[model samples]
Target: MSRPPRHDEATLLDAAVRLAAAGGPAAVTMSAVARESGAPNGSVYHRFPQRSALLAELWLRTLGEFHDACLPVFAEHAEPHLAAGAAARQVVAWSRAHRERAVVLLHGVEAFGRAEWPAAQLRRERQAARRVRQAVTGLAERLGAETPLDLDRVSLAVVGLPLAVVRRHLHAGTPLPGHAEELAERGAIDLLRGGGS
Candidate 1:
């Protein structure tokens, strides 16, 4: 019989996230994660070769959760307008539910040093970008707007507007209002309808 490893990868990452949340990314060194997680330093290195890898994993993991929560709305709804609203709502809703994760995500690549991320992590980021583009394009066509939908406008609607709602509360270290999701939904619909610009 074999004994299971005491400090798993998720444990170390969780420690990293907490450290990052508490003291920012600068506080997330391997030694620090080990101490924070009560794991051996060797275990931290086994899961992540360097601090950059840890930062990359932290970034990718949080964004992955965001995409998982948000993308299904786009895939499931037939009405582009409703789908747009739902996606926006989902963004704020997810952020509100995962406040610490939201804070990390709101910091973005600047906190993680995008240039230092490994190639595989960069590819995942690119794939996420592609998916967002495809969803936006498809939704624009479904809406049948008179003007062609550019990436910028769609971004403003789907990501920028919703993010604004989330950022205000997250930055202030306050809980978001219960109506945040609904407000985001309306903002996204208006932006999509070409009335919010």
Candidate 2:
């Protein structure tokens, strides 16, 4: 007799990410994920009754990984401005390295709606956004500018700068331009210190 199958939440989530990244969110289904994971469909439903729950868990895991990826920037630089620039460049580098996953995350549609899952996903997303924004705003504040800069605008610039650059490159099916990292770093710096330049 075959040994009892062993599958865990992590395995399901990994399969989900792979499926979604390869074929977009619409391709991720209970049977498809189970087949990819070598588990039964009931296992998928057991862990995540709806696809949205699976998507939410997958996205949360992605954010955790992204945050860990950026953590090194802060470790290397204690200064807020330098750290912020390093963080932006690092994120861009990660996107280049993980193009499929990055693209899936950057532009994919959310197949699952708020009504489909626990409210915790929404709360976690908002908290994560706030933390990232706070990091950017703190960097801007440390620029020693004569006048106080607009925190919200600078925060949006800081967050959007890397994404915009990566989005264009991925959409074009091209590698990041030679100056992409440099531009991302400089853009972050300018947004933080250059008075909205």
**Highest lDDT, which number?**
1
What does the lDDT read for residue 125 in candidate 2? 77
Please report, in order, the local distance difference test score of every candidate based on alpha carbons: 0.83, 0.72
For all candidates, the clash counts are: 0, 0
Candidate 1, position 43, lDDT: 92
Candidate 1 worst ten-residue window by lDDT: 143-152
Candidate 1, after superposition: displacement of residue 8 in Å? 1.3
Model 1, position 1: C-alpha lDDT score: 95
lDDT, candidate 1, 86-160, per-residue tens: 889999989988888888888877778889888998898888779877877776666664455454676677788
lDDT score at residue 5, model 1, on the 0-100 scale: 77
TM-score, per-candidate, Cα-based: 0.90, 0.79
